[model samples]
Target: MNAIAVRAATPADHPRIVDLLTRSWGETVVVGHGVRYDAAELPALLAERRGRLAGLLTYDIGSEGLEVVSIDAVVRHAGVGTALLNAAAELAWAKGLDRLWLITTNDNIDALRFYQRRGMRIEGVTRGGVDASRRLKPGIPLVGDYGIEMHDEITLEMRRPVGSGIAQPG
Candidate 1:
């Protein structure tokens, strides 16, 4: 993790960032669902800051608010995720966003736990969402860890109480 600092993604980081996303997704969900997609579609969202592979994050503007479409921490378990999560939330709040949310596949138990520990709550479930997503990005699969069909997407959110510190719950 040498020189691996927690900074915003830069235009230069797009290649490495996409490489990370492609490799992460290719080995991850593709074989199960039997699909494919252009990883380049993700770079615009992973905009750069200080350069290097610090991390990647993208926002989704909705009627309700801006949601976190994707988040990639350069070094897992190095507080990188927390830093990014806090940064995203602060920006969302400043811009008057109602909440910040993201989606994770069913087999991502580690991520579920990580976000949960960071005060994010499982708000909803998208049954068959994975199937729908496969139409766009076929790399997703019906099978995940332990041979479980990755049939759903879990929606997570950070809800902030007005005038409270952070939107995250303990």
Candidate 2:
């Protein structure tokens, strides 16, 4: 495997990111915090390996902190996700942010485990959050991977000082 290269996304990378999000989420509009974000327009970090787009992590940098709107690693278990996440956290710390956060559906046990192992903790859970999101996208499935029912949104947060390289309890 070639070494992974992570970098800030350029305007030319937008459509590819949109394509990835569309393929992964069934749409390019991500509804979160009662707002819909066009994933193609967001700031993102892209991961490249062997001249191929290996992964993407789109995020919102707000006054509070950074929110990971969507993340996809087409090449699974290849350190793509980790590289993108670290790059995002590095950006957050560079921007003087305090923390990073993201939301995953209830059925995404793999996501929960992955984020936790990376030092994130459950900050909140929006019961029936998918119901509200479905109203916006309408493509959200009633069921998800592993045949699990999708019902709620679980919020995960990492409260460590940006670039601390430490995962402390939130």
Candidate 3:
């Protein structure tokens, strides 16, 4: 499999990056979800392979810590998603963040498994977070990629030392 490169994204990468996100997030729901975050929302990073953007992530620096606002990846089972995740974790560490976190839908069993495998622990659940998100982004459907109801948002949290060496966690 070809490898994807992870790096900070510049404004030039916006169009293509958004294209990938559009495909990853499902466009109708994205616009209908009624949640519109302009470019000023956060600093973004992108993963590319063979000069094509494969994934993207956007995060904000918050008083509490670094908040990952959105992460979109394509070509799953390839290294793009994991590479983006590893890079984001490093960014959080460099900024003295205590934890790296994100939220997913209540019925997202796959995401739950993926985060756990990456060493993230479930910290809390935002009951009806997706529903609230839909209010902000009217395009978000009542259900997710499949027919699963999108109600609660599960918050996953993970801490990394000043550096996250690839050693397996004990």
lDDT of every predicted structure (CA atoms): 0.64, 0.85, 0.69
**Model 1 residue 10 CA deviation in Å:** 4.5
Clashes counted in candidate 3 amount to 11
**Residue-wise C-alpha lDDT for candidate 2, range 1-170, written one tens digit per residue:** 68999999998888888889889877788887567898878899999999899999999988768999999999788899988887887787677777889989999988898888887889999998988888877877899879999989999887765446554546
Error of 1 at 129 (Å): 1.4
Tell me the spans in candidate 1 whose CA falls farther than 4 Å from its real position: 1-12, 27-52
TM-scores of all candidate predictions against the true structure: 0.74, 0.92, 0.83
RMSD of each: 4.7, 1.8, 3.6
How do the residues 1-170 of candidate 3 rate in per-residue lDDT, one tens digit apiece?
47788999887776776666667665412321224464333588888898887878877666655556677776777767678878888887776777677767777787778778988788788777778787677677787655788888787777765345442221
Q: What is the lDDT of residue 132 in candidate 1?
A: 79
Error of 2 at 119 (Å): 0.5
Error of 3 at 81 (Å): 0.9
**Candidate structures ordered by lDDT, highest first:** 2, 3, 1
- Winner on TM-score between 1 and 2 is 2
Superior by lDDT: candidate 1 or candidate 2: 2
Q: List the residue pairs that clash in candidate 2.
A: none
Off by over 4 Å in 3: 26-36, 39-41, 162-170
